[model samples]
Target: MKLWKRAAAAIKDQKSLLAVGFSRRASYRNTDLEAAIIKATSHDDSSVDYSNAQRVYKWIKASPLNLKTLVHALSSRVNHTRSWIVALKSLMLLHGVISCKVPSVVGEIRRLPFDLSDFSDGHSSLSRTWGFNIFVRAYFAFLNSYSSFTADQISRTRANLRSDKVDSVKQQLDRIQKLQSLLDLILQIRPIADNMKRALILEAMDCIVLESINIYGRICSGIIKILPAAGKTDAARSLKIVNKATSQGEDLAMYFEFCKGFGVSNARDTPQFVTIPMAEVEAMEKMVKSVEKDEQKQEEEVVEKAIVLLEKPRLQTIITDKWQTFEDDEYCFSEKAIQEYHQDPLPLVVSNQPVCYTMPDLITF
Candidate 1:
């Protein structure tokens, strides 16, 4: 039989011996059985031996034996133990089996029968108590798992780095630097109270790193995209606008008009004018001239109609009532003199004519 198969069979058959107090009449002596178990769990360098150790460790962990018996067995054979794998396996099994009961309690609370208000009521006090206990257990379990996973990842990473042959020294150093930077950023963000904000920041970091990697890879592969010659193109365009402006008389006139409207003086000779191509200036001038000609034609037509109307000759109306007359002879006297005569308590003198009774005399009664 293979050494691995033999080791596995030995471990399986000796299970009763490894657990509670073994019967003295069992197949193998207690001392020999304990020796075989120690040898099986210990690292032997050979592939077959290591495989057997892994298999036995797995079987022992999955077994339904009580933890107290296992711990006792481990402690009794601690001196004979050649590896910590057995202890680790035992602890993992104990944790896994015992921890399974805690989550069901948590699920019960999570799916609680009563509403949130029931927490303060006396009648639902027992449910609240059990809910709180379960929540505490679940919270601690989560914290333990989180910490354990972090430690395991860190340990494995360190082991990989120490192996030395798997990667170059420079690559290892770069990875360490990146990890340090990540740790620093994590510390900086630790004080944030919002989970979503923290997650967004982490996601942004991931995206930035991935994009940078892609850009670097593209550069290394010599696949850079061509960009327009910025300096040459810009300079050429600017020169074109300036040359066009100097060539167009109408553009110069428009530019000066704009400057004047904006209160800009030409004393300093500063180029405050925006330039356009000569063709564009000519197009604009043509548009303006067309509009002006249309307006002038409309104005001339209106004046011609007015002249025709004047030539048609219409009769002017005259007022029959002398009080309603608007001729200048009605107001020949000085206004001040008339006002004074009216204010005097005497009648006006007429040149040898009989006085006629005015409407005011009849109204005096």
Candidate 2:
């Protein structure tokens, strides 16, 4: 009664005192507010009087303690807690200017569900986003928790994001962009001892098999045939990249002539090429034989299917046996066969270059 009387009197007579009280005790821990809240709400709106209860609630909300206290008091006293939370939520819905402590603000945002697509403002600016402040907090929360912003750099960026209320929606978006860029940079900096075997294998294939001297490698059928270039080696480097390796080359000098193009390797999505054993290619040939003729013809068809699936070398040397090497155009498909294979009638270029695979449509039958 005394607190209520004091509040009622303060609202009616001393508005400045109530405002000062709210200003000091809203965010800080305070002793007077709990007793005031209890006193202010103990009676019906008319009984304790509207002015007092209204003033007290306003003070509490202005203190920004309403949400913080509502969250802290949500426990076994479910009904009372629910009323407080419901009232706080109503206040949140009513006001956008109000701000609370970061942890409490984070907890409040955690209670709701949001779709990422809902926040696209479609404004031309890079910094603009819809659902501005709430999404900023939520996206930061989402990335840190799900994306595991666990790296030192990411953790630090997240800390910075939480510590400040970015001035505008655009600023919030920029902060997120900054954080992601930092995260990407961190990912690219591999520790000195850590090994990335996939990348290393791709580098090898890019260097050895795909660009290997006097050889053309295809992974689908897993063939690496050694071509006879003047500088081509009979003794190859690592053959771990292919299933079958044959010292065979198609002399395109008779079919076409040498030419040059861009020397840079800009190809993407290079699958891991490793040296598979001859046993695998043998097993493949045997598997072809194992398939009945009704299903697919013999080993030659199997090799052909492999070449087809591999989708390389418009002309490939189809060796029936391991000893059948390319002596001349007898084992090779004619230019007519090569020309008919391509649906697009673009004239093909045959080059006597060091690495023959660069000729996009070179084939051997």
* Backbone clash numbers for all candidates listed: 0, 11
User: What tens-digit string does per-residue lDDT give for candidate 1 at 187-225?
Assistant: 221112222222222322232233223322332221111
> CA lDDT, every prediction?
0.36, 0.33
Identify the candidate with maximal TM-score. 2
lDDT of candidate 1 at residue 154, scale 0 to 100:
52
lDDT of 1 at 130: 44
Candidate that would win on lDDT: 1
- 1-365: candidate 2 lDDT, tens digit per residue: 64774465345324422543565444543435333443343322223323434544555556455645433322111223212222222222212211222332333433322223223322123242222323223332333332222233244456668987423333332333343333332222111221212232222123222222211223222232221110112112213212122312222111111111112132233323344356644544444444444355567778998988988567777757456546575434767667766866677788788654565665774
RMSD values, in order shown = 30.1, 31.0
